[model samples]
Target: MTSAAKPEADQTVSGQLRRALHPGGWSLRGRLLGQLVALVAVACVVMGVVTEVGLRTFLLDKLNGQLAGSIQRVDSPIGGDQGQLPLGPPTSGRLRFLGGGAGTAIVVIDNGTVTDAYTINQQNYGKPVKLPPDALAAMETVQVGKRPSTVDLGGSLGAHQVIAVASDRTPGRVLIVGLSVVDINSTLLSTGLIMLGVALIAVLLTALAGELIIRYTLTPLRRVAATASRVAELPLERGEVALSVRVADRDTNPRTEVGQVGSALNRMLGHIANALAVRHASEMRVRKFVADASHELRTPLAAIRGYAELTRRSGDKVPPDIARAMDRVESESIRMTALVEDLLLLARLDAGRPLRRQPVDLTQLAVDSVSDAHVAGPDHKWRITVPDIPVIVPGDEPRLRQVLANLLANARTHTPTGTTVEVAIAQLDTGEVRISVTDDGPGIPPSLLPEVFERFARGDSSRSRAAGSTGLGLSIVAAVVTAHRGNVTVTSRPGHTEFAVHIPSED
Candidate 1:
């Protein structure tokens, strides 16, 4: 498709989706289900983050409050000479050994001389310390350990450190305490991961529960689809699937597609049943008309035969005019016979009589038919055109020849003496064989084109003479072409007329 057509096509699809899904601007069932899942997941993530942050804040507040209380209870002065200070009570069972572990220490600075004042362990506490430039700058401005400072303790320590401060109520100096935030961070991360694992399991269960709810809610719809499939597969001619087979009513709710489909199916079945009844009645009428017409013709035929025999027995004793009247009777009888024979042929074609089919050379047949028409209508010039090779097609040869013959004869009888009839046979690009019979004649009127193939229809209905024609020739051609699963079309104008036949090559 061109770019200009793309927008139109997209608009069509958008319109269809809107019609199928929206109906009245309300959320569809599928979208509603999806929204529920998304909302639940988002709520889970938000709650998880809030809870983790809240826990971390609470731990920090309790730890800082305990540090203040411990400092207030100290009896030593802040700027006293370097010495160990009195140990405090345990903050918790988890943190009780902090004052005497390898990872714990305390230090004090007074009069420009730094001293390892309170040692948790001599080997770990005696290590020399140095503060990072940024940490030292931040420490000088804030009071409470500068909100958890990190510095380096070099010489027996590493390039990374933590420096926390505590001051006694009577102190004239600052008491600094330090511990690695690495341990605290590792513990917080492990707790967060555990919480995340629990959250994931909770989310999984929630999603599965949501899916189950959706499946349960849609049970009615699934039942309706299965019922529709079953009903659609049913053969309507058998009159199965009574009205009781209908989908259960969902009240007057038109917002639901399932409801609309159910309602539509019920209405469609009602229409089908009515149409099938009318068709059955019409078929029966047609069968009876054909049977009655056939029976009626036999009576007149028998009467004509009886009268002719009587005339034959009477011989020359009959009046001359009476003899002429007998000849007229014979002529009328022959006409009646021809009419009956044509009717029988139509009936057989209508009833789908089997024909002998084979791979017939249509090119050869066209040449023969055209030559025969030339001989028959010596006044007209007939021409035949065929492919260089035989155009072989699978069809009944006798019926196919009859099609060409009828077209040729119609042109011969209707056109002026000098008119030309042309026959062409070739294969179309779609692997179908085409045969055309064209003539240079005063063509049929446009008004008669529509029903030209109807039984007993005549293009020239206002003939003055009673010609020996039943007017079923084109109708027969249509029937034969239809039985072969093909098509026949005619194009006609003043001084130009053509009838083309298309049949499948594979056929």
Candidate 2:
């Protein structure tokens, strides 16, 4: 079945190709253009034919009228019974060739007997009354009248003129005066050939001009693409590009699309320059942060190692004061471990590692975190407000729990023993679960609000009151919410401070 279907598909495609290649169904632009030109040429030829035929008909009508005048001039015969008519002075050989004339021939028919009158071409002189079939056909149908009639002979000699008039001087019922139009046809043919040749040349020239127009019109777009490709190839890590790195804007013609592209490219280059400068500043800040973090960790680790060595060497001889110092060292070492772990978690989050996500109830998470904060610092009044209805949000449950716990813990460490710490979870109208931890503590100064989410940024750096967890609690909150495609906002005032986490609902 598959093999049969494949052949059927191939046949269908081949049939389409055949249709596309048909005389009236060209598929390519070039082929279509050629077809259009051919149609125009054919139209020109048809128009020329119509024009030539009309002109010939008009001329023949006039010529027959002139021939009728010639017949009237032949009034009386010079001799009797011979049917020889008197030739006028400007008679037999008197007819002059009209302007660019070739020659002429004449034949006369009388009383059912034909007589040759004159012929410029000798082979046709004095021949039998062999009229063109068209002329003869016209004669058979025409009545004997003074007015001449014209009949197209349908060759080089387009039409022959014939007139029948009363001739009392001749022993004949009618006088058939006819003429051949060989010279007139030859002139018409030559003129038509010249016109067709000129028309073909003009069409060719027009097509060439059109091609150049299409090329020049599209040049600017090509330049813009090339410049963009070269710019894309540049290393963004390089701190700054010299002014020499600019692309060619001179070739851009502003009156056209190319010109607009040039203008846009210049603007793009400006944006790229600004972006690179910002990136460099960010890299410097990161380097400084790393240096500061290493220095801070080294001191604590060295202190712990030194104390451990002293304790091991002294054994029972070490004084109570030295033993207490060793205990302090162990406690500090544990704090350092916790700080390192927090830093590592923050680093992973910054690097965009996927966090564990599930449907977590923010209200319940807030309660649990507040309870933990109250136990951690029994002196602080930790208050939590959870909605009656469970407000469910998509997030990592532990991380959401940790986020509230860290904020409450910060409140405990910063404020005095009896400061009220409030955690609230409420659903906002914009399909988000809003969780805010507000503390009646000394608020963040206006100057530090912008950089509050930066790594290791802290409002109060006092040794005794500094918040634990590597000073990245707010930063982790920001990163986690950002990963969930949500937002974290902070508003702090002297007697009121709030950090809100707006996690989007799963629905």
Candidate 3:
């Protein structure tokens, strides 16, 4: 790959990733599952927080009560002069001081210096246990008569429920006693993590269950959609539209919302089928009338021209005014005959009349058609370019020639007298013959281009009506090309307009 393309490829992949992860872009099923899981997650998180706060408060309150009872063991008036702890079975009471577990610690300070310290089993006193700095700072901020509070102490001491009070054993001294809350914090953390794990499991289950339930609920709606889809693929725009498709009996029960949709769809399809039938009948009648009238008018039109010519040839004395009138009558009759013949040809093509499938040289047809266009509009420029090789295609010879003539004549008539018209015939790599007529004239109006090939479609107001176009030329080109199992299209802009026909080439 080139260096320029690498960044573009990366950007495309990144864009795809962003779209997949975006919540708003998710499908209906994904969104439903996500919302359900989110609700479950929020509920779990709120429950976990409330439970943690309540448990911590209860444990702290219990620790404070233990510190209060331990204070009674001190004796007053032993004074700062002595550092001995008051002796007693002081351990006894509703207090259980005798069994003060390893988590308990108590200390006494005189003049801001530790004079005595003890712990359950009396651990670490010989090494001189000291009160943590945070607890000491918290004691300085305590107001008189406020409830005892908790402080976080350093290292092994962890967090504590501590109280600052006067030493009963020594005057001008202080007591800081606390029980370790490491066990309480440890318990809360473990339980919190377990609760978090359970919350995750609940969310996962909610997502799975939501997806299953939504799929089951929408199953009937999907069946109804499939029924409509099959009907949409039918060729309803042409000929007979047999719309017999309907939703299943179970889907059309009408008790559920999906069932209501299915029932309504079936009714709509039925109405459309009736409308198409009526349209087909109307079109058949119109085709029959045009065909019959054109066939019957041909003989009269020929006789009118023949008698007018015979009168001009007769040696008898005819008045000058009568000869001129006969000329006018013959001219009008010839024009009317051409119109009738065009209508008959269109009606037959619409009726799907078969044409002879002979191999015809498309290049020769372009040459002959351009030659005729030159004679018809000698003032207009005419040109043709054919490939050295024969551009052979299959169709009726006469009909294909008519297709080329119509296209060339359309270009010559719509363009100004001095405009240039060119006809081209080429065989495409895909083994189709491409015949195009291009003109360097004022293009068709943008608004009219879409319907330019419709029957009797006329050009802009500025177009000269003196050319006597029956407006069936391009329409015939389109119809005959279509009947030969081909396609026709046109494109136009200022100073350029082109009509191209593609027909399958024979081997």
Pitting candidate 1 against candidate 3, the one with the higher TM-score is 3
Computed on alpha carbons, the lDDT of every model, listed in order, comes to 0.65, 0.65, 0.77
Error of 3 at 119 (Å): 5.5
Better candidate number, 1 or 3, judged by lDDT: 3
Ranking by TM-score: 3, 1, 2
For each candidate, what TM-score against the reference?
Answer: 0.48, 0.44, 0.79
Residues 269-377, model 3: lDDT tens digits = 8889889999998998889899999989999999998998888888778889998999888888889899999999999988888988988988888888888899999
- Per-candidate clashes come to 2, 0, 1
* Model 2, CA-based lDDT: 0.65
How do the residues 28-88 of candidate 1 rate in per-residue lDDT, one tens digit apiece? 4556566776787788778778977887677656545544433333324433434433343
Q: Tell me, by TM-score, which candidate is best.
A: 3
Compose the digit string of candidate 2's lDDT tens values, residues 1-507: 001234343357778898766766653345646755677678777877887898787777767766665554443343433434333333442222221112233434566654434333325443322445554545444446656665564544455565666455566645445555554576678878887887788678756765566556556667777888888888775444442344575745567666777877777788878777787768656745754685578676777767676675666677789777877777667677566656656655655578777888777777778888888889988888888999988778877777777778778876778889898888888888788888888877677677778767776666533434456777877777787778888888777878887878863
Judged by whole-model lDDT over C-alpha atoms, candidate 3 comes out at: 0.77
Model 3, residue 393: distance off in Å is 2.6
TM value for model 2: 0.44
Could you tell me which residue pairs clash in candidate 1?
78-171, 151-161
